[model samples]
Target: MTAMPPSSPDEPLQPQRFFAVVPAAGVGKRMGADRPKQYLVLRGRTLIEHTLERLCGFTPIERVIVALAAEDPYREGIAILNSSRVLCCEGGAERCHTVHSALNSLAGIAADSDWVLVHDVARPCVRVEDLQRLLDRLQGHPVGGLLGVPVWDTMKRTASDDQVIGTVDRQHLWRAYTPQMFRYGVLRDALSAVLARGELVTDEAAAIEAAGLKPLLVEGAQDNIKVTRPEDLALAEFYMAQQEAGQS
Candidate 1:
């Protein structure tokens, strides 16, 4: 939970640059769609397109690196992938592997102190205000954090037989969401260590935690939902419309 020291008034302060990474290698079997879920049409554009636009349009971020399946065919059709600010690389099978691959691609370009925000391609409704909030809150932090929301639903625990085992405590419980921000060196080393142990972390924050650091979870809009399954498409569409209408 350490933060960087404040610079002296007489000395010039060098701000760390922000970079974004996206892992779009998943086929999203749960979506039951013809193509990969990221390529699915949303508001007349692919989900990946919307996501990239959001990240690329953000003023703080300098470049966005997207890791796609080695044989991905849909990327070329999306014009945004050709943007000079967007870099593409071959991805691995799993989410962690894909993210690690993107990090490897960033080597020699991204400095150790640079900020890297890893976001999900399925989350097209992520708000810019949340991204700014994460940066504002985590500025100069030694170990970065992510955008999340407190879980307000009733707790439920089920057994293999579908019987309720017990009701878990909900206090201080939160749902982990994407755009998990961390220092380039810390994240890369943490992921490398986890990968060396053959451990699969579902998110960047987990890898940071495994490295013996706590990631701050900044409260974010609940509308930043991950689009999964057939029903999620409609839900995402609704959220997007709300966002555009200034209602979200």
Candidate 2:
């Protein structure tokens, strides 16, 4: 695997100003877990802690802001957070709502021109180099961008009866990944439009696309999968070890 380029803190890159909003409010019912996925232990730290460490380590990111559930038990995570540079805010009932709350915490609040990266707390495997690439690509774009992997495997269109209805044209199909980057004001308006239409967006990219803005997709690492099931934690742990080994 090709390694991500190391970003130097002393030589901080200009042009890209990154402010991430990580949403970790969803109860992982599918995982059949007792706690939220972000709070789950991975490699001696909470998954979120690992994510924040990397995000803050990158020089381009101005700040790391997390949107957590209102009733999240904090004492266990407090000291870990105190050791890092991330700021925390209360999340709302829905994903978009939480993002709105988190963005409100931004002092100046981004003008329509500023950029915001909406990342998934569960997607802890997002690589700094890949993120940097996406940031670089977004600088000149008319709208913004998202990190995604091309569809390499044949896709199936399933029917209600669990039978394959037809084969999908997988040539240009790809799964969207978070750290979905976008212009702050455009995203805000897009999200507002989604709310107005009473539609549920699986990710911020949907909202941006709904606003008639094109978000370019950058090729992302395939290992950067969102953690959902218990087994996924094991895979994420292995990926983490691979990352540390690479850095070493």
Candidate of highest TM-score? 1
TM match of model 1 to true structure? 0.95
For all predicted structures, in order, the TM-scores are 0.95, 0.88
Top candidate, metric lDDT? 1
Error of 1 at 129 (Å): 0.7
Q: After superposition, how far is residue 13 of candidate 2 from its true place, in Å?
A: 14
Q: Tell me the tens digit of each residue's lDDT in model 1 across 14-79.
A: 788999999999999999988999999998999999999999999999999999998788877799
TM-score of 2: 0.88
**Which tens-of-lDDT digit does each residue in 1-248 have in candidate 2?**
11112345676664546688888777778888777878888888888887777777778777777888876884254464564457778887788888877777765855555678888888888899898999888775657889999998989999899899999999989899988887777777777778777887878888877876678899988889889889999999889888879941
* lDDT (Cα, 0-100) at 131 in candidate 2: 88
Instruction: Give the number of colliding residue pairs in candidate 1.
Output: 0
